[model samples]
Target: MNVFDIFWLFFMITALQPILRQRFLEAARQRMIAKIEKSRGSRVILLVHRQETMSLLGFPIVRYIDVNDSEQVIRAIHLTDKDVPIDLILHTPGGLVLAALQIARAVKRHPAKVTAFIPHYAMSGGTLIALAADEIVMDEHAVLGPVDPQLGQFPAASLVRVVREKPLDKVDDQTLIMADMAEKALRQMKANLSELLAGKYEPQRVEELAETLSQGRWTHDYPITFDEAQRLGLPVSKDMPTEIYQLMSLFPQPVRQQPSVEFLPTPRKGHEGGQGTGLFF
Candidate 1:
């Protein structure tokens, strides 16, 4: 082919790539929705967000980062009538704390029982959100990480470097300066974590966990298996089969209306009853 023809061909491929990918994604999403709809027993609303790493049948897989937008979750929750229950299939590395909290709160507030299904991993803020659900279901290989706050690269790494270089006996001006900045970063991160862990853990324990996480010493901290989560005061169960992972990856769509338990509405006009039926779920 001529040089100009080759250039044109490259341009065409680059231009069409995104469009073609988008079309394929949409088709896959439709298939998943169809599958879920065809399943027997119980009504379920599948909530997927765009922050997920993978897109099955055009629908974004569930991710912690995706839940940061409370409005999106609120919209989705509003779409559900008081009649149906929900099964939240989660696979995320975690994201913003406030967003996760908001999602968890919404799930708790809903009338339907929210069951968080972890087919892969739920780390950091993802763990926080999982706590809000009535029950958490995991496959054999699924895991949950600690709810430790991170200070990011520039802050945490720089501080550690300064601390290492400066000895107690002798310290240069630059080293002292970096050390101070690092200390401040660490303090701020700790405080943020403490706030997030309010009512969940004591301040001192939260600090300890935050430090370990911020330091990034281990590849992963508090890597709890499905059984461990149950032992740790979490309502956890093993339901999804391992083969489902392969099926999910290939089909990219979830079967709809699978059997799931619905959350009962809070009663009105009693000791814990100041709200109306409209406020339930």
Candidate 2:
């Protein structure tokens, strides 16, 4: 070939290298997706919430399970018959008390079985939702935390304790009002926890477990291991399916300082044609 023609050929090959690499990456990702899908049984839906990741830009900001999510999942369940099972893949640092309560209630009351799978961490309100599950599967390193409800930025138990321990004259009127609200939140939380444990334990024991969990016996984010959870009256198993790690690999911690996209799909080889053979990232 002529020198100019050879140079042109080399340039074309170099230019297409990135396209080839992207195609390879896309293919690998598709295989992983297929594997995860295959592991799930027929008529099962996986709901995942990874708190360490940022969900939407210019939105409510922090990524945590919320009321809006309850609406979506509940509606999705409504569309299907009661026979389908719901698998919750929970890994969260917890969020609003009421929001978590809404989701826990929906899951608890679902006609079909609801299972919670925790590979790493599910704390505070996350624990509340996990409590509602028919069965909970956890890894040896996995943790389900205290269900102590939070009011505003403070734990309800802490607020209530301060009011009870401190002199009435020393506390401000405004603080007293806040403490009153916190007490109410505590009651609500205890009642909810008791209800969630209804079928799992006796009525008196249900209230006791609820009190222990909601009374700030442990820190809100304290990691209750698999054994600890079982001891505390939660229906938890140490055995977790192998495919969960593959799913968790899909979500990495958020880098708040930088703007980024998790995946970006672009045109590769056959994409240039109307009938595309594959997509690349």
Candidate 3:
């Protein structure tokens, strides 16, 4: 009831409010993860690809799942008990081909059901992994993209098309070499697709789906909406579980990157202070 006591109470509330809120949010996130795990009778695993978002003026962005992500994924999978199903929350722009296939097979062969939840989009390699899931859940607005593989930074289909459109003899030596590489990429992708679709689809549909997805019919980034996926006979549903949304809420928004920084310039041996540029996120 004294003026000084009231003022002290106000200062503490102002200082502690943010901390309290953050703690509450953290607890909620864990609860959501746990609830989803309990409901599915599976351990939850999140695989999010790096977003090409801007970073802080001089900071590094957190890396997302790419082809190199297989090592970590396999480790994570092994950490879980064998009896638990895998509730995979997949969000990626796609990465390495071999890496994707490794993950897809792991999920497909797992004894328990693997349910893939797509809150927004999963493209290329991400699509391959989703196909491995027993069930894929998405919202009406969510999308799964085409599975056309990328060879390095180049699109496999484009590379193959160039060779198809131009006669091999007409092209230069370098072009011929690239065309050969492209041909190999196409063949490898076909083989991978066929294997991936093996147990998931009927013997007939498997071939058809593989051709449609990997034959460059659609662009690599083309968004296949929930309705389109269902039409294609994928095991997909538009109704996403509430727990999934709650779990997604814990992550930085799609456009936002966690604050991080990486310094460039390899510090030489015996070098004390090497100048470096900073990438901010």
The candidate, 2 or 3, that scores higher on lDDT is 3
What is the Cα-based lDDT of residue 115 in candidate 2? 83
Q: Please, what are the lDDT tens digits per residue for candidate 2 over residues 1-281?
A: 99999999998988776567557755664566566546664233344564342223323345777777677766765765677677777787777687788888888888878888888888887888889989999998888888887777787788888999999999999889989988888788888898888987888889889888888888787889998887877788876766666656655444457656644444444654655345432
What tens-digit string does per-residue lDDT give for candidate 3 at 34-58?
A: 8877786888888875433242232
lDDT of 1 by residue, 27-127 (tens): 77566544553562223333333343333343555544654356676677777776566666666677776676677677767786677777777786677
Model 2 regions lying over 4 Å from their true place: 1-61, 254-281
Candidate 3 positional error at 118, Å: 0.6
TM-score of decoy 1: 0.56
Between candidates 1 and 2, the one scoring higher on TM-score is: 2
For candidate 3, the TM-score is: 0.75
All candidates in order of TM-score, best leading = 3, 2, 1
The model with the greatest TM-score is 3
Cα RMSD, each candidate:
14.4, 10.9, 15.0
Top candidate (lDDT): 3
Mark the regions of model 1 whose C-alpha exceeds 4 Å error after superposition.
Answer: 1-10, 37-68, 151-220, 241-281
